[model samples]
Target: MTTFVLFGGTGDLAKRKIIPALYSAFVNGRLDANFSFIGVAREALDDADFRQRVLASVSASIEGSSANGGGSTPATLQAFLALTSYCKIDAREAADFEPLKQRIDTSGANAALFYLATGPDLFIPVVQQLAAHELVGDNARVVLEKPLGRDAQSAREINAALRTYLKEKQIYRIDHYLGKEMVQNLLVLRFANSFLEPLWNRKWIQDVQISISEQVGVESRGDFYDHTGALRDMVQNHLLQLLSIVAMEPPVNANPDAIRDEKVKVLRGLHKFTPEEVSKHTVRGQYRAGAIDGKPVISYQAEPGVPAASRTETFVAIRAEIDNWRWAGVPFFLRTGKRMASRSAEITINFKPIPYSIFGTNQRNLRSNRLVISLQPEESVELFLKTKEPGEGIRLSDVALNLDFAEASTSRRVESYERLLLDAMHGDLTLFVRDDELGAAWDWIDPILSAWQGDSEGLKSYISGSWGPAAASYLLAQCGSAWGEEYVED
Candidate 1:
């Protein structure tokens, strides 16, 4: 039986996502019955208290289960709660791990996963502490969450620190987005289906748009948000990883190295942005007070721990390019923001218009074909094709052929973290980002960060309930493009 140890187990991520995910997995019998979960935190809580917390957290959310077409029941909840236990230990001190070591030794499971859900700074120390207690065995795996570092050098430092205790294969660097059902489907949508492969290039794809927008500001994590900004927090990891998946060449096989090899190639092909080029390709914005669904909200500056003069961007938009044959001139537009008009995460692939319209003069300004993979606000894929307008004199209109994954899949849809955690247990590195990928991503993104600082591009302000700064629209307009349909709330 495999044992999972969660450091910082009483923290928000543990309570809200990790524990709940474990519960769901446990209830479904995906986790072995002999398995044990040992949560370690500074807080002194007994096993019963920890179980109650898990029960409370899991029961609060009404997540739709794809398996039953219903929510979790009290019986299922109780059964899952039985698998958990807690231990109190300070992650910083190696000596504090004695109790945790005793618990693991007693469990008698050689296969263990040491999940560091704490901040990045503590990652190394936690591993060292675990190593001191002999809790990190030869077969054990260590999982580290994102925001790996503030920049490339820092990331390397973290990697170097980890290497002192763990090997590259033993470390699982998770990017939860990769675990999402829709994200995994991206490969299937591109490679499995023959319809898209031939046209998946600069010759046929006019441009691609990747947007990850949030409707809420940094209500609680203002301090953390102030330092990281939109670029490092979202673009460097989440958005860039998505771009690689969208633009990468077909892997030799679906194996870990095969898939990651193609992704690395995509990252390497990224056209590095010069200072002047950065100015043209990027735009940063900070949200100002405005109404969201008729409710007045505070500006980013008003948030706790944020100074009035803070230049930290709440929004960012960039037009990136891959300098390879497959995607030479095609622009990949990436945008992410907080306090946007609506919450959405999607990728839109705009196919080039036909060589010459047969109904040329009459059918001017007709919409081109588009493939949209919506990751949130319900996961679905839509193919927007030009269709004949009914009762029209040779008119054409665009309509979507949509496929909703939630409605189609009969099996239970696993949460992103749930699938990823299981993968970590099974030692699957396919969905996790490797060091080379990380370095390449930072290499491509570093110049943009430097350009922003050198240019002193103060955060351009946009209304709270808006798409982003006007410049974002103009950035796309220069390429004769625009954001896909916005979700308007009633």
Candidate 2:
């Protein structure tokens, strides 16, 4: 039995992801029987108003969810609603926190999970207020959402402030991407499969690519997007985190810290860039006016709150290498962008090609085997292998041995938020980011950022609704490879 306090209970994230996820967890019996929610905000909403907002968010999410409300009976919904309450307190005002403190004390919550869904600026104040009011429980936990900071120094400041009041064990820095079923499945695919582990090293692999593309522009987030470009916004956290998981050495145990320790080693293993290497290994592109599916879209410069003179990159392609025995000489290509040809987030492993084709040179265009873990418009894994084409002749063709998690399973796919949020409630930090991991990631990223700051090379341009600038492909071409386009959404 625990109490959940949502700091940004009425914000867009809560409305779209958090609230729906909590409700789904409740419906699935993933939550404790004595669990409840305390929706905290400065909205001046009473208990009833907050419950209604939760209902609306839940209803909207339900309509689109494959769970279709998850066997939630009216009585159960009401029971869940009855467990909820609200508090209207300006976190900036220390006095207002007293009321929240009193309410928590009265409720007798064994442990409380404080979720800071608000901006980075609010994290410190809220933690300070919670400490001052004596509302922070010995068994309490705090959940932090990203972007942790605008950059490394800011992230360090935030961590320092939080540490002043909360113990490291009590902090859970959540990254929803890690909560995805397929991402979690990566462990099983590698460790559990005896056939794949021996060939997991650079000796049997060529290069790896982690591509996360988007077909949509900044929309209303131009103000935020303008200040944070592709490298800082995406590559620093999401992309780096993915790379760590893919490249990390096997941990000693399944303990949360053990897994995290290995992950941080990967981040630290990332080859730091020099000023000159930064320019040669990285490509930054801004989207220009172009067509998507036959319709034209405005350039990133024309987006609301954007400056026409803005050189902020909407797209970034990076060639990263881990300086470790397992991955030495194996390049990890990381690229992500807005207003691209497809909406995809996938990590593709290109295995080294056969030294000699058994079927003779007649097998034209014989390609390397590829293991693609896609987490996008669809959740699936496909192993592209060369197969003998059924015929009287010795013809070979590539075939995908596919594992579509959605199609093969009858159980409802768990939402990323649902998995991570529930894990936070259960005090499971396996999927959350650690402070050292974050620091190491920033350490590796800061040099490139500094180089980009001083670069006169300027931004390359890619037309909207494309796979970014041709320069991204060129980054791979240098290594005798290319970006995988087969999985791009149509």
Off by over 4 Å in 1: 63-71, 486-490
Candidate 2, 335: how far from true, in Å? 1.1
State each model's CA lDDT, in order.
0.87, 0.89
lDDT of 1 at 291: 88
* Model 1 per-residue lDDT at 413: 84
lDDT of 1 by residue, 1-490 (tens): 8899998888878877888787767767778768888888888899999888777777654453433213567777766667679988887776778877888888888699988898899898898887777777778999998888878898899999888888888999989899999999999988999978889998899999999999989887788889889999899999999999999999999999899999999999999988889888999999999989899999999999898888999999999999999999999999999999999999999998788877766564655888999998789999988877889477777789999997888777888988999999989999998988998999898998888887665459999999999999999989988898532212
State how far residue 413 of model 2 sits from its true place (Å): 1.8
Return the top candidate by lDDT: 2
User: 69-181, model 2: which lDDT tens digit per residue?
Assistant: 87777887888889889999788998888878888888888999999998888999999999987767679999998888877898999999999999998999988889989
Give the Cα-based TM-score of candidate 2 against the true structure: 0.95
TM-scores across all candidates? 0.95, 0.95
Residue runs of model 2 more than 4 Å from their true location after superposition: 73-75, 486-490
lDDT of 2 at 353: 87
